[model samples]
Target: MTRSAPQFLCDPVLETVQVEHGFGTRGAVAPGGTLRPNQVHGNAVARFEGGSGVDPLEADALLSRIPTQSVAVVTADCVPVLVASADGGCVAAVHAGWRGLACGVIPAAIAALSEWGFTDLRAAIGPHARACCYEVDTPVLEALEGPFGPALAEAVRPTRPGHAGLDLQRLALEALSRGGIRSDHRGSAAAMCTVCHPELFDSFRRQGDQAGRMIHWVRPIRDA
Candidate 1:
């Protein structure tokens, strides 16, 4: 893939609401006042009210009710999920890996955000290691089966012994579906495979711990 300016991908649903958001690429900078969690690959969420809370929250997701106070999550190969209400009064950023997914990060975050109200929720899954390059073993498969059930087979194709190519994006969409977001309402503006495009993304699967992470963020629109 050709390199572009440090930028972010926008979801049409979020655009309609005019929320300042982005699924970032390498070297990309998000909007101001963005707060990110430490991301332990668990389902926990750190929520902020009108004021900025402590930095480096020990959670996999960040939720913001303050209009200008944005929330973000960083990832190398793991999925970056950005969610918000239609008017952008509430927003969340999630770091979803196979572990987080199996542990229910998506639904957990949505359930947390729902406390504000579940009306017109929208979500977008960002770039990560795609199925074309993301392969998993039996234990990983078994862990995912709880959340994916019979549908898990659809996103998997046998690879090496005890391994299969897994579509992280498909599973992510399924998780969002469980959270009440329709297929059309869920966004994939930057669902490209991070492993496939080293020119544009930083992939841990491809570059290991040395690989850098990309930032994804969302901010509620301040009421006029």
Candidate 2:
């Protein structure tokens, strides 16, 4: 069966940079077999050093200084984050689901980009399950609040009697802030909830295993 091209959401902040980056919706086609990791909902980050062929390793984030190599991550309801240095020397793609976010994937990606001499980093948080529909039980709440403390806890509001809605965007911003990315360096989040907009995106929570995956990608522009 022929797959349709993915609908993409472009970040205006990232658009100002000398790089190509965007978040894909269902059916998006990634050029050049973009490097995608087998996200395990942990904080493991990998650095790509310009290689040939696709190597889908097990990791949640990917960083690269190679201008020709594009890096991406697949997600349904998970947050897809794209990062690039202000100078466009390096770029990174991260898949941060609630588990990955709680464990520190954003910080890990930032640290990796920092090691690549990318100090002034800019990031974009793509669409996912927002607080309006992302209700979680006590353990998930504890897992998020335990590591992030009150600020994150404050964002979690009771959705019902026992479940609370967690704001993944706020949590991701907190992690980015801790990693030294200021609000000015950040792009306005797409903010569309994947679960709420089934026509535009795929949601794992809504569609289960049958949900189609979206690919978010970034690449530095090589000088001719």
* lDDT scores of the candidates, listed in order: 0.87, 0.84
Q: What 10-residue stretch in candidate 1 is worst by lDDT?
A: 48-57
lDDT per residue for candidate 2 within 89-195, as digits (tens), equals 78899999889988999998898787777889889999888877788888888788776998876778877777888888888888888889989878755758999
Backbone clash count, each prediction separately: 0, 2
Clashing pairs in 2: 6-27, 6-28
lDDT by residue (1-224, candidate 1, tens digit) is 99557878888878877888888889999776678988888998788886548334799988887886888999998998988887778888999999999999998889888876755788998999999999999999999998889889999999889899999888889999988898888989778899999988999999988899899999988992
lDDT of 2 at 71: 91
Question: Residue 186 of model 1: what lDDT?
Answer: 92
Error at 13, model 2, angstroms: 1.1
Count backbone clashes in candidate 2.
2
What C-alpha lDDT does candidate 2 achieve relative to the native structure? 0.84
| Best of the candidates, TM-score | 1
